[model samples]
Target: MLTPYLAMFLDGRGLNSVEIGQLLALITLTRILGPNLWANLADRSGKSLRILQIGAALALASFFVIFIADGFWGLTLCFGLIMMFWTAIMPQMEVITLNSVAGDAHKYSRIRLWGSLGFILLTISAGRLIDWFGTEVLLVICLALLAALLLVSTRLREPEQLPDNSPHTGSIWSKLKSPVFLGFILALCLLQVGFGPYNSFFTLFMKDLGYSGMQTGLLLSLGVLAEILIFLKAGRLIQRFGIKWMLLISLALTVVRWALLAHFAHLPWVLIATQCIHAASFGLTHATAIQFIHRYFGRRYQSRGQALYVSLAGGLGGAVGNFGAGLLWQQGQGATQAFLAAAMVVGVSLVVILLIPSRHLECASEPAR
Candidate 1:
């Protein structure tokens, strides 16, 4: 719902590509700052759920202001505040989930699959709603969901801390300075930068190539569907291939996938086919990274470790990529050229993965229940 309306919202305001890109960059850059700040508090208080409820409430309230705000500055202010609150939700949720799964992290797939399922259901329903009622409906529905989530979130209890196995840690900055950890962060940052344009403008790209809105939703669904399958079996794949290998494979596949879409988005089937690679490009990479950090970082620093990773990779990388893609998309160099640029970034990321030290790896089985 948010995906489709994002470009339209800016377009509705008559903002140029550069302004749109900067707004998105500003929005996502909060991801970098928000997570680390909240992550530290969560660790100190061991109150992930409390952080989530508060953040969600703030986010919900902030976004409601968006429906009434007009003009660029007003929208930007509200949106930035909303993003600051919103960005805090996912990293903490992830930490909560990690705590819930305890030692048998492999089973994360079973639970995480519901998120993908929700996206599919919501994407289809939201698409239909937009088709019938228009994009404003999307914002209204988003506001409603956020409000409902804020209410329901209070019921979630924080998981009891398990016997933490992670190493004792210093400051977040020192951990980040480790060569291997630094390498992984850099790789993920580059990887997301490559993805920024696709996430920001893929629908427009499809429409430009003459695909209809319904087809665009279906194609996006295909990517999620592929992700569902991978989540179901990602543990087995990770055990077989290891995190480093999985990371390499995902980056390689992303390079191929983005390159194909860049040049061949005109063919609906071809784009659909390329979408299947999301399983590796997104699903595998995500699962592997989380597990990898769990194994490498000490239990005490889990939140900090995850936040650091997300801040650099998801926050910084995503911001740069979003802005760059916006500029490229606006330049009218066409989707093909923009996608090719993304592919090249992923290619560089693959090399970075290859350089990470093998000594940091330590896979331990969860004790039998």
Candidate 2:
């Protein structure tokens, strides 16, 4: 929703591309610290739902400050605070949902598709609203959405886990050290690093290439639409191909997709074609990795499991990519250069995945129950 308007927003506030990238990097950096801490808190207290609710409430409140903040630094302060609270929801929520489904954790895909659907609907609607009313409407609308999320939070019950039968107190460190799991995270970070330029600047890039606002929205929504479909079938795919293979393939495709983006920005069909890869690049990789966490980590450590995944890959790796891309972007280098660098990141990630042993994958055969 904020994608198209970000360049304009930052430009209006006197930030160049590099400064905008730096701030975006910082926003994601919060997840590196915030999510792991919150997940650990939830682990000790068995209050994942409560933590989620509190984060929602805080997110709703922070937007009030965001709407009123002036200048880059003020907005940065507001964004930092808001992200610190907002980043905790997904990791723990994944743990909750995995626990909820129990033996049929493969059904996670069907459940997660809703988020992609929400993004598709909101992205299109937000574009139309911004075009009709102007970009300033963004904060007000986001505030309204957060208010609704606060209400939504109240209705969600904390997920229940199967009672622990083992005598040994399990540590998250042991669960995380499985080389396959670490390799998976490294691969995803590279894949997402490739996506950094696309996420932060795609709308502006399309506009520069002469696409209309509505067209930009359609293109963005198209990728999410593909994601929705892929997510619906993720469980089956994970069963058929296994997580390690899935990660490797997805990262490989990410390299190709970003290379295409770098080389073919002006070709309409190429733009559309590149987005089809969302299925593998994001949907498959995300679903597979989360499933691995569920398989490797028991219910007691699930929140921390998800948090580790989000923090290292989506948070820190993504921040590095976004910031680096921003520097390249501000140098007056073309979009192609940013995407090419992303492709390189993914390539390195692909090499890292080769070192992961497949024996750790035996757990995928066991149901979450």
Q: Give per-residue lDDT, candidate 2, residue 138.
A: 76
Can you tell me which runs of candidate 2 are displaced by over 4 Å?
1-5, 164-170, 361-369
Write down the lDDT that model 1 would get: 0.78
lDDT of 2 by residue, 292-314 (tens): 76666666777787888788888
Model 1 TM-score, all chains together = 0.94
Q: In candidate 2, which residue pairs clash?
A: none
Per-residue CA lDDT of candidate 1, range 149-202, in tens? 888888788898887655434665676677777788889899999997787787
TM-score: model 2 vs. ground truth:
0.94
TM-score of each: 0.94, 0.94
Where does candidate 1 clash, by residue pair? 166-298, 166-299, 167-298
Index of the highest-lDDT prediction: 1
Model 1, residue 323: displacement in angstroms? 0.7
